[model samples]
Target: MADAQRRIAELLARCDLEEAQHRLGELVFDAARQAMPRNLPELAQLAGLRKVPEMFPGATPTARIQAAIDTLSLAGGGTLVLDGRILEVTDTIQLRAGVTIDGGWGGFRAAPGFRGESVVAMRRRRIDYDAAGYARATNLLNLVIDCNRQSGVGGLCHGNAQKDRVDGLRIRNCLADGWVVDGGYELFGQNFEVIAASRRDGGVAPAPGRRGLVVAASDCHFADGVLQHFPIGLHAPGAHNHFARLHAWSTYYAADPPLLIGFLDEGEGNTFMACSADSPRLADNAAPPGRENGGYGFRSGGNAINQRLIACTVQLSQYGDAASLPPPRTIIPVHCGQVRATILGLEVRDYGSAGFGPFVTTPSPAVMRETTILGGNVHEGLPTNLQLPWSEPGRFLPRLCIAGSDAGIVQARQFGAVTRIGGLAVFELSLCLGGLRAGRGAVTIQGLPDAAAAPDEGHRIGFQPVLSHWKGGEPVVAVLHGGGRELHLLRQSTGAPVTGADLTETTAISVAGQYFTDMPGDA
Candidate 1:
């Protein structure tokens, strides 16, 4: 303990305090690393604390550990290492900046029992504005969270520090609610409720800042973890954040409500890459929207300015009703401003009953590109404002629905220039044409093998042909709209299937399909 205190004091005495703190962080991290032994029982041990489950009779070791952490925080900044027995944190453990909790070899074991609550709860409620905004001053560093908790960690992360990283964390089992920040909530009790001020109107006003992690975070990465609680996995509302190599297995909601590592607000930018989410199994009685409302894979508010979804997989485990389904809004982007989102190299399937937002309002400009919309039944049932006029004048290209999407197209009213690239086995079924306001609308198609030779079947009026793609080891079928659609199948490589639908031009039309070139052909 005296050695740790002397280290903190020496680091504080540096000329460049912040830089010194970072250097100190490296040193402390190295110490923690050296302290961890590949061989058990050789780890460091501190005095004055008893083994968790074997403490001084009635005294709770978790409480004692927490008290020690609180005291160290009040003392400014230090490290706490937990070893030996299991420490079950029944209540919230508030962590001040510059404090690192390293749970040794056995890791920190926390589970929810009796109270039926989630294990390892943090951030009891959102901090008030007058208080700290979860911001960091390089005070908190090396928060190594490695555990074997049967139930995962509950509560939004208040890690609003710049250049902070949470890595090599392993969470398994017991996932009711993953993590919620800004406007995200955990399903600790019955219903998942939003504690933000935006949700409470006619009721008792929520005490000033009584929410979750709503701080402005930057350069944070939540990587190499697994959260299996379906629906809302991890919600982040900060800027310059990255979510990589995480797996979410949700059993309650199908692909209707998607799971996410975290969500960003309008002023923030984030990227989600190389992630996977699986829906609930088909046989269970977990009735869809039996009574619940507003279920989505990912739900972003009106302020998410720029975000990207790259190389992700969202698959449904069951087949449910498409018509009598509980109006599940697939991806809800309400009144979003200037944002550039690219969803690429996606593999989606089993979800046949889903829908996208109708560009539903007048907005300035927004762009979505290189997205592969597969196996989702995008029901364009009604004409709603895509909400584009509210944005400034610019070109918006949501080049999406590359493959395996059904009825995957829409239009916004009084919108700017829009372009779409309908890839292999895609059908663009439209209702009231004005909804897809392509000021100078255009379509580009590619990668179809059937249309290159036979110009006859390319002109077929009512033939729904099945295109095959590999899934696991078996071949899966994808249906595309043929006949009546104005897509001129250029070569055998870009032919549409057969369709019973009609294609009209409410704005203006320029048809380009499947490597379709205008000159001497061979496109």
Candidate 2:
């Protein structure tokens, strides 16, 4: 009721009351016809469309739609084309086996090549087909799945417990995700696919375990879209899957890592094109990754097994004392794998403990691939390095951290100890900032060179700061490298893991802060 009232108010505020009332009348009339058979005959009277087709001269499109639904309910395998501007189901209607539902494309308004409508406004869908039935549809635009009054769980899109395939659809702005996967014990779908889709701005997270496009199978593709504030965006647990050209941000925790593939699988061909990682914390907690403050980029702690990550980008926002984390310090606790990573055109800065090296890997053995750490930035902490109490053979490619203000390029060893680094390159001395403080937590980067000779040494990299501070004295020339990239900033004491609540709080603060300035997660 609140939502309806809100929409009504929005219309009234944006449009003339007379026009709003007319649209509302049409919606009510459409709803009546679908729920009441006696009302079906009157659908034509309300819409002014003839009941008889000019050729058939017998029944209208509205009648045909009803006839199809009714006949299919009996004949079993029929296609229903619904043309009324509004089709509301006040009651539950089970669509039996091999049925197809065809709704208006409004001239491809809700699809690609045409940006007609992004929102699908329709009424409830208790429309049941056998959980194991096979059904298909295309172009479900501005269809509202209002279950607020009908079912306790109000959602925009709903499906059967078993196998179902929905393709070439665009569903936007509803009570929830454009398409929803219902929760039931039944194990459905031997194979299901949703290709070329888009979902944007819906209500807040739909309960505890839901997402923009939630699936539980072996094959699913959620390609292309601008999804925001969707709690669990693009969540799929089935293995042997592929995710390409998918962009997501401001989601509490996206693409549940291990579940997307398997705990022991590889993520080689997957590409997270220009995605942003923001604070996930919503409230306060004492744990490092708690909801205590509710600001976070991701909560990918599940399957930390053998997984290969390639061609992905991550950008994080920081605040307060944590604003000075070092390079590589920002990307930490990497699991075990013969992972081939290339860090081209990357930026890491602003946090207390910038980077923590090679987190504890799984018992399974893994190798480091040709990791190119070039054209990047780092801040605050030491060239943080950390090695597993039990691990070996750490390697990289095009090994380099550019020199610049707020770019901390530390030797891998200083952060932690590792068996070996394949290619090491420090283009120039990056300008780094501060380190962690007391009570938060602490990290230690060991094995980096304390000092080096010109050109070859860590200090002689390039772009020495006009001023710097080490212990209580004057600043010195923090040597830069060959290329004018990377910053050699002051290091601080290591801090503990961040608490979840703190993250949330920080993120909220940042968001609120952005409204006053520039939005934080715009890209």
State the weakest 10-residue window (summed lDDT) of model 2.
Answer: 508-517
Query: lDDT per residue, candidate 1, 1-523, as tens digits?
Result: 3454355445445443444334332333231222221111111222111221122334454555555554344433345555533455555455554445554422334434423233333332232111455432212222222222323344324432333223333332222333333222121111121211111122221121122223334555556555543333445555666667655543332222222212223335666677665542222123421112323333344545565556665444434334223233333322233345444444343344343233222233333221212221122332222323323422322221213231344332222232223322222221222223222222322223223223333343232222212112221122223322223211233433222122332332222223221123221
Highest TM-score: give the candidate number: 1
TM-score of 2: 0.41
Q: What is the C-alpha lDDT of each candidate?
A: 0.34, 0.30
TM-score of each: 0.44, 0.41
- TM for candidate 1 is 0.44
